[model samples]
Target: MSDISDFLNHLPADRARTAFDLVHYMLGKALKSEDADEVLTEMAERIGRAGVPLDRATSIVPLLHAEAVASARFWERGSGARSYLFPYTPESGDGYAHSPAAVVHETGEWVRLWLPETPDDTYGIVPELKEAGYTDYLMAPVFMKSGMAGTFSFATRAPNGFSDEDLAFLRLVFPALAGAQDILATTRAMQEVMRMYVGAEPQRRILSGDVHRGEVMRIRSAILFADMRRFTELTVDMSAEEATQLLNAYYDCIVPPIEEAGGEVLKFIGDGILAIFRAEGAGNVACFKAIQAAQEGLDRVAHRNGSPSFDVGIALHLGEVAYGNVGSGLRLDYTVIGRDVNLAARVAGLCGTLGEPLLVSDTFRGRIADAGKKTSGGPVSVWSVGVHALKGLHTPLEVFAVAVP
Candidate 1:
């Protein structure tokens, strides 16, 4: 390989200047941790101002994610950059196969197609590019050190297409662009992995260097503990794969409602779940949201009553929770703990024993009444399900079951 200094010396004066400026720009953006969209948008402006006919620019990275196949950002001459996700689907694959990027990815080759001379059927996107007054289209492979590949494409409205100098300048700056993209994509993938394992706040905290063990925050929260009913009996005859699917279906009924109501699902303890809703706005909003989330979760379970059905007992309690990192040695776990969390779990146990779908602790019930004072729904209706002796606690606690609307 030739030295970069020697390579730059061989380029024309203008192209060399543009390439040098762009390398510096890319480095600055990468060091500052600017997102790909911002980098691409600014890159297009700089290249165009440098006498390159860059009307549109795009960066597409094919990453392995649970839901998405690729992440794309496109910037146009007069518009701000926008992002799109190509989901893992047959249609997404079919669309990619008809585009020039797929060819660049498969062949590890660059493509420079003059859109005005090319047939509309040449590439799936050619007709749209031509209609948008673009005459030049270029796609180049950006291979990462991880062996995964991405594509960067440029389009221009200039009738003569991109000049040799323009193409050379872009090619010279490609390494810098690819380096920045690799960093951005890797960071995004790490964040995605964290999101899959932890709630939003925990993910943020961990990413922000707050991962030391014993780092905990105590806050008042409405805790909800729930466990699937008859999970073992229900899946006893099923195969492991089938049972796992059933469990996922059961969790689906519970997790979304909790997340939708601004509650964080902290842990999935086998068939049991522990989540919390912190008090926000006018005090008892956390209790109200927790109650509403429980009801919604129960409603979703009821909706899935037939064939492969799931039933759960949800219990809500209110108190302080110590939330954060707890573990030993090099390994760690982020979770919420406190007597209140235990009380919530105990109340959840009562749901199965008392044959109730939703149960609220006495403290939680009072908060519901208080929340009702501020909400349009008023106090949630409930009835005492008798004072029951929980496993750990000495005094018998009064259990209350919520009313169906």
Candidate 2:
């Protein structure tokens, strides 16, 4: 490892001051920009303007997200900036382990190699870049106070490769770039976590400072309530890991179709899922979307069933709901609460007793009729299942069962 002090000692005072001023300006601009791509583009421009013969620059930052482990790459070739997300899995570990960025990450130090002189077996990526006409390559780790480390790799096609002065100047300005990266990474992580737990719109609303308990908004929506049939009995004898896997499989079947139909899954209540499709203008578009999602869910569940079948019971209702934050001061949940939400849940409970896979409220059926929107399943028949007293209600509630042909 080369001593950082050696590089610092050789840096001229005038050059050092210029680097400092440039980094200061970059950091100030980064603080004001929320877009990561813009920040990276500006950094690349600044580096090129500093008299370095830069051909390409790449930044690899780890992120917190489902299906992705630790790397998102930003590449700048000339003036254009592009980014790619690398999803990590156990099967993909080998490729990352052998990468040059991995060496910098593991050592927590700089990995500088003269591409023209590097041996074929020295590293996995260097030989390729050398063949592509790169003379110098440097990979450095960017450490943040948050303990997350990112990487910056600079490449040049300049015949003589990077000078000691160029490396020294980079060492001085890297901390400022890393600081700005930390801020962006933190914000992105928070957004990812919030969107994963709560629905997307709810996450945005909560982040925008709508946190007071009992603060509610009345909006019309097509509500869906779905639960796995006999989930308790099925999981009673299974191990904890087995139960979790079973639940995830059920969600895999339930979530995608709803999301594909432009519905937001609000919450998971044990084995049950609550989702909504909010309509922007007139017409029963929300109702149409909810029914389409329910049909897709039924089809997916049927396809997922094996020798011993796993089934689901789904109910759809359309009405106004109170969407907001509700709970104690210390603990709060952002979800929907209203009579319509309760009625949807109660309707879902009747699926097993009524011997039907899917049910819809009379109000929902009326909205479909009023809007003249045909079911996506193409001319399916529906039958009135007689008004019956729901558990918590005094008045008899009429329900309809969709007969899939």
Among these predictions, the greatest lDDT belongs to 1
Query: What digit string (tens of lDDT, one per residue) describes model 1 on residues 90-157?
Result: 67788888989889988988998987679999888988988899988999888877677788999988
Question: For every model in order, what is the number of clashing pairs?
Answer: 0, 0
lDDT of 2 by residue, 9-114 (tens): 8678776676777678677977788666777777777777667677878877777788786655555465577777778677766766777777887888789888
Alpha-carbon RMSD to native, per candidate: 2.6, 2.8
For model 1, what is the alpha-carbon lDDT of residue 342?
A: 86
Structural similarity to truth (TM-score) of each candidate: 0.90, 0.90
Candidate lDDT values, in order: 0.84, 0.80
Query: For model 2, what is the alpha-carbon lDDT of residue 42?
Result: 75
Candidate 1 residue runs with Cα over 4 Å from true position: 1-11, 30-36, 63-65, 90-92, 116-122, 280-283
Cand. 2 TM to true fold? 0.90
Model 1 steric clash pairs: none
Model 2 spans with C-alpha error above 4 angstroms:
1-21, 281-283, 305-308, 370-380
Candidate 2: the clashing residue pairs are: none
